[model samples]
Target chain A: MSDKPESLTQADESALMQLREEIDRLDTEILALISKRANCAMKVAEVKMKASGNAGAVFYRPEREAQVLTSVMDRNPGPLGNEDMAKLFREIMSACLALEKPMEVAYLGPEGTFTQQAALKHFGQWVKTKPMPAIDEVFREVEAGACNYGVVPVENSSEGIVNHTLDTFITSNIKICGEVELRIHHHLLAGPNTKHDKISRIYSHQQSLAQCRKWLDAHMPHAERIAVSSNAEAAKRVQGEWNSAAIAGELAASLYDLEIVESKIEDSPDNSTRFLIIGTEQVGPSSEDKTSLVVSMRNEPGALYHLLKPFNEFGVDMTRLETRPSMTGNWTYVFFIDFAGHCEDESAIKVINAIRETAVDVKVLGSYPKGVL
Target chain B: MSDKPESLTQADESALMQLREEIDRLDTEILALISKRANCAMKVAEVKMKASGNAGAVFYRPEREAQVLTSVMDRNPGPLGNEDMAKLFREIMSACLALEKPMEVAYLGPEGTFTQQAALKHFGQWVKTKPMPAIDEVFREVEAGACNYGVVPVENSSEGIVNHTLDTFITSNIKICGEVELRIHHHLLAGPNTKHDKISRIYSHQQSLAQCRKWLDAHMPHAERIAVSSNAEAAKRVQGEWNSAAIAGELAASLYDLEIVESKIEDSPDNSTRFLIIGTEQVGPSSEDKTSLVVSMRNEPGALYHLLKPFNEFGVDMTRLETRPSMTGNWTYVFFIDFAGHCEDESAIKVINAIRETAVDVKVLGSYPKGVL
Candidate 1:
């Protein structure tokens, strides 16, 4: 939406106005379609609730949602990329899902954290998100039916794995329902009253400080860098300090009424974090799916090798394998593994069975769609 | 060491005093032994410099240090556990190594981060630690030979992998020299002047707040929780706020002059983070070692399955496998894999060669000693 060009002739201006009007008309039709979709979703909830006697009707079908997203991207002949097109549909579908059932998602948060962002991105802004103090609390909130689902950080491209999340899975019966990945962008922000040249201090989380080290060193060499707990808190601190600025995100900038001093200051452009959507009920297979499993192995020589052989034999694509010390044995370890395909698939079933032959225990976490956005 | 028991008789008191004297005498002998070790280290450095014509004298040998630490634990007839005994010798070796060459280490830091703790834990307190604001800076500092080694957080048990660290490896030539794991403990702290009943706000990094959710819910539910950038920053913020408390670590508490209101308040007892030591030089094989590799594969139907076949066939214990989008390709992925045994091992070599037969490219990140603490 560019402003009317000053060099445009009267005829061209009239043509531009007509184009704008046409866009407005298309927007109206789009709004009507969205309303129709929402109404259709409410009917879906009614049918589901009535069919299940209003007991435990699972409105959120991972496979179904994945199918919808896949079709949206596949069918899109867009001016935008497939990902951008799918994301627009993602929000539409999320709103529709909420109409079917208002999802209360518990996320690891104090608000404005990357995990919260992932929750909204996955569930859409319509679902109510409650900030839980810890990963396990998010699990407990969902387990106790206080929330329908939970979102927690599972891995980062840089960080290996969230050990606590994996550990929680070992003891808790919570199932992995879905997944989302969020690109992390850190911005340098300050209060409006602060003079850019006079800024003497910078506040950010330790990782943020590290992520933006070169930028800070080159741009604000004199500022005393203060590592805070969260970027949101750093933005909060800057609100009360004239000589201080914050390294945070757009969310925190708006949340704390801060101005962006410098944007996208992270050292690596590829920095992104992956979050897991967890719930009690199992997720059905999506078009492109991934299955998570926790396998415990006795402390025998070549234990890890034996546990992974099934995937190689069955041509199953293994995505991730993280080792954690098992709680039950002296020197035993458990492997948190993620492999392609749903558990119900023949190859996946065969692989799991084969792993179980040598493994002390093999617990299927869940099979969920691979992240759409 | 404990004080004399209150009910001790005259003879018992004398025996206790004698034991204390003996301990004091042993400590003096230990000091002499440490001094002797330092002198030996200095001599070793001199010999290395002379042999290499002072062009490059590698004073710090990861494998050698690992061997020493292993022997220390193995020979320990301990009232202390193997880990505790090894830690004591770790500090001793650190001091001795410092005497050989004053190693300057760079780490992701704003001074009081867990990353700094991991750096100190891995390198010992004797080396001068320089806090770099970013992970890549830590890598660059080492790469540029500004620092002897660099430490960065590779993963958190609760949060997963640090993507920037891994991404940096793809473009940078920094070597993984060693690995260390630190158990994370979050404490509720406040300024000395802050009244316990008047803690209207609680500050911490988002992760810490999540980690300590249960403790806060049970203890201070009414307080407003604020997420900051780092726990140290939270501790720093609480120093001037009479009505605020911060959840941080012991380092943050002392660094910011805060009093601990509660200790070890994380939701999960197993909360920990793993850090990587990056340097310019390759490390030789240690008794217990792990090799890291970055393998890029073509976008094939069963690319992941084919990659794992070698590890399975060679009976290599695959510990970790993380997938990241390839930088050069639209849909291709690069796997950051970790497995038991050094690159020099016969099985590891066979596996690497087998993988090379099918994989587009494989880059050996490093083979380093597994974390001892």
Candidate 2:
């Protein structure tokens, strides 16, 4: 029953010390390269500001960043997988971007929402993120120049689209600067004083509650399920409650000083959400990109058929097509479409031209780099 | 100014009495007609039971109900709008259906969720509704025959699809008996003694907070937004809190004994959610119907374009097409497609068969009557 540490042989200890020293040497080289990259980014910022003749120059180029990440993944000769290697480069790039210009991002929040998680994932930890009360406020923040850019959830693999985000685009002139997708993983968390057996209630966002419905039902059926505005808020509420748990993420657990009761409780293994990085500047193509458009079509028998024909004819790959009631008239509808390719591509131009001929109106929301992480 | 009432004259009083008498007579006739309808429904149930050779008869027919509502709307000649008139019939039909069978429904709830409201709206107030903690439990309830049917949100006009509901369909064999669309309206409510100016916190579901983001920012900019499981849950939490308000629906307000501080506070005027009714029995076509399908596509160039071409060629009007990552492999996707026709229709069959030629798999989620109310 004795708990004693086993001592290593003198020869083994020497080998371990050598390995540690070698790791430290590699870290030193990596640090030097990261510093050099940051210095280069600062120089690029100065040139951009001078060329634009103003301090309000755009430093966070999504297309450029996407290309960098793509190249990192493509050329990775890794013991680590491509995604893991690119993630390390992603942080390095984010630090460099911050050096170019300190960026502030606004997101739908009461802090630990998946939107905030997506923002940090996309921009890296270097950028400051502000939690807006609403999706529109996120847009307003970017549009009003209060924040450099805003991040909003556009769609969820399990929950569907965030209609408010799309509707906000119809009224606001903000461009879709980039796209990022984050896999949603929910955790059951509780404060330190909480008795696991005495848990009487569970709190979460309505969607989160729905996402973890099966796990909750199977494990804690008697515990009352309370829907909240955000998972972070749920964690915050549970922080002061002794007999309750919150279904949030690891970030929320860390943020609220809670312990994980259960992890990755979402019903679907591939549950994920797609977020849009909205800003004033339109993003260029990164070779691989997507274009989103809002198209208002005539109320006719074959309106949808005609609207989709150009994509088929031009061989453009459509990722999504969603219908919403048009603001102009009753029974009239508008379609929100996402397709592969930059809007400026030759085939894209022809497709847009053909759609405009038949559609009542077509507004390209933006063409931006596809999500890299 | 004088605080005096203008009394009616003797002639006016006599006219009012005559009108009241006439209204009472009309009410009697309406009651008799309702009774006759209920009697007819009971007889229909008996016939179905006898045909099935047991009491476990499928008494509720969503397609039949849709037809009844459609005819009631189409043939109505009144001061009330078509929707209003059909609503009255909906209640009547609900009452008649109850007489045939005391249907029990399971739904995602702790009581005042939009899902519960949708269930009541579709099934009417007569059927008993049991609130389930999760979406899968609702399916389980119906599958286990604990409840005759279940109601779950499928998609939102603004929020997007309820991925849990769709994912639940992947493993569950429940048939989508019908669909019901409800216009979502949120209210800012508080306990009667709460001071509006002193309110420091607002409670609601995350989506509700997003939906009412603009209204809250414009009115209660300084309040801390709290996310909860459901709007009803928010209303319940706000009931005893003097310094807090809740964003909820009229149903939650009434259920929780709260007063509306503001009405219809959602940001989008046309904000709505679509719900699906799940049962063991399949629904026949109501002439006007929609079919939902889950199609898994191969990872190839123009896979989407090829999948959509058949729908266009067959003239099967596609309403929605949503993509989600497939469970089978990386980079593979499955689409949830909704089109304006039953699965049995010639055009729909042509389209489905054509799609089967290229798609990896296609599962007919259901061919249910379109939402009539």
Candidate 3:
């Protein structure tokens, strides 16, 4: 009876070992397949660039990705759900894009800022990153051959347009290459050696703290909050203090050797930030594209009405409109408008000429392919 | 001479007072105009809803917004730049939306989570919010009439798809009512009394720590990292201990009476999150709209090929596709897809039916009006 039991245990152990070996083999095969798939994506990017006359155009299609994911889910067999399969593909595609082009991107930053996040998402890990102190610096970097492109915040879903970026666009020669939209999450962090009980000070960027005003009012009515130059700077200051902490992102925690004392601490979960990619080179034709331009008008009562008449008559779709104070004149303005359709298109050119007749200055910022992600 | 100086100072003070009064009057007029504009928007929303046969349809147009901003910038007599004027109008429109209908929202949290930040962005301050314990709970609450909608994380730009929310959608009856995107920032927070050097531990949700892994590895090399249920819980725990800190949002600083030790501590400055608003209600048409659906297939070769053939043939544009394993049957799969165009459109219906012919089960999640933002 004892021998029989021992034999059974041995059989079970062998079976388990065999299962492990099979899993390992499958994993290796999967890795190889993924690498090959990525290589194929690079080839596709090359083909797309050649077809469109742009060398670095992103070729991945969101619609196509959706189709691939759907197929994978249809073939999936097990505990892992369809979303899981689709997620795996999404990462794989991201990695593939990174491999296709090591994008060099510039963004407004001290690092660990939301603008940096946008750069990463739009360009992926394949790109090298350069941090600029100001929005204009980002533009300069892209324009001066220091980077392939620049990412700058144009608007926040909650706070509205980032005027600095828009203003920079009015004067800078850089074109609107692409756009990436990101969701914003803010967290509070502190250094490792600090004690929670004796804390008396808090530090963060003014905007970071302001977004959580309601939560602050309810929980920490007495703590003194100090504004810092940037969230990264705040993280730097909290290095050795026990009572003081800073509101920042994950980058700050890692950069400052601090620990995350909290997570996903933003007051609203749906907060999103939209950014524009500025580059000297125009993007190739995409199945879907958006064009941006600036139209300046003399300060007059009906100038605005007359300027918009072209769009209405021509049936042009405009996406965004912003104003910048005219640099050369007092009490005059320049209008920055983003609309659907390429500048190369006949109707677009017609509309531009018509608007120019009614406006003092008109410049095409750039017309490029729209980002699907 | 003494009288002249006094009179000059008095005149300056009077001018300042007059300027303040004028500014106040302008603000009042602007407010009135905003109110009138919002009232007009409500009427438009009403007309759109009546036309589309859906009650909660979004009528605000992104292209229209672009045009409005451009017009405002063109007509401005400034000190304020074009971008500044557009930003002001963006906020005004956002506030106007709030007046049309105060959005009701639910998020996964005790509080101080990233999702909360996203929710605030989509609905703004005017909306009513309720926090739920889990993502599914949020879905359930929205489904069961506890809230009008729920905001749940769908994907992260870096970490990829939030599997839990997507998996829940597979079986749930709720539809994706809307979406909000956010940029995530993490912070280190501690109580007011703790010393920085005495802090020995850090706490946050597991995902946040993962996102900030590079920053933590470089900075807090010696500290022990701890994961909690949420950033809010971490904040709550830090209130009783002087030696501990929480990694959370600005809300955590106020909620637990803690001080910010660091701010903007994310690995990527552009760290943005995308969330879906789930509800029982369906969305209506706008200038643009997107539709989502699910299909299940038997374990057969070429099943997917046949399913997708219709889309290509009929010229229906699909945006996203994802796969999930079939829970009811072994070796079977389910596919989730998003496409441009409404289900009511002729081409869309034909493609959908063709896909249904090859798939064992087909379900329409819902057709939604696309976001213009």
Model 1 docking tier (incorrect/acceptable/medium/high): incorrect
For candidate 2, the per-residue lDDT at A229 reads 78
Predicted structure 3, TM vs. truth: 0.40
| iRMS (Å) per candidate | 35.4, 37.4, 29.8
Docking class of 3: incorrect
Clashes of each: 28, 15, 132
Native contacts, share recovered per candidate:
0.00, 0.00, 0.00
Provide chain B TM-scores across all predictions. Answer: 0.81, 0.82, 0.65
Tens digit of lDDT per residue, candidate 3, span B1-373? Answer: 1112122345444553454344334323333333345455555445445544655454333334444445555654443344434444444455555555555688876444567757655554335676665799999898887787788888764346777787787788997766667776778888889887777888888877777777777767666889887777888999999898878776557546687787777787877788877777565544456788888899799978887899999998989888878788987788888899877788998998998788898887776555433
Candidate 2: lDDT of B305? 97
Q: What is the lDDT of residue B51 in candidate 2?
A: 50
Error of 2 at B267 (Å): 3.5
**lDDT (0 to 1) per candidate:** 0.77, 0.77, 0.66
Give me the iRMSD of candidate 1, please: 35.4
User: Worst lDDT window (10 residues) for model 1 chain B?
Assistant: B1-10
Instruction: Please give the range of 10 consecutive residues that has the lowest summed lDDT in model 1 chain A.
Output: A1-10
Model 1 DockQ vs. reference? 0.01
Segments in model 1 whose C-alpha atoms lie over 4 Å from true places: A1-373, B1-8, B186-267
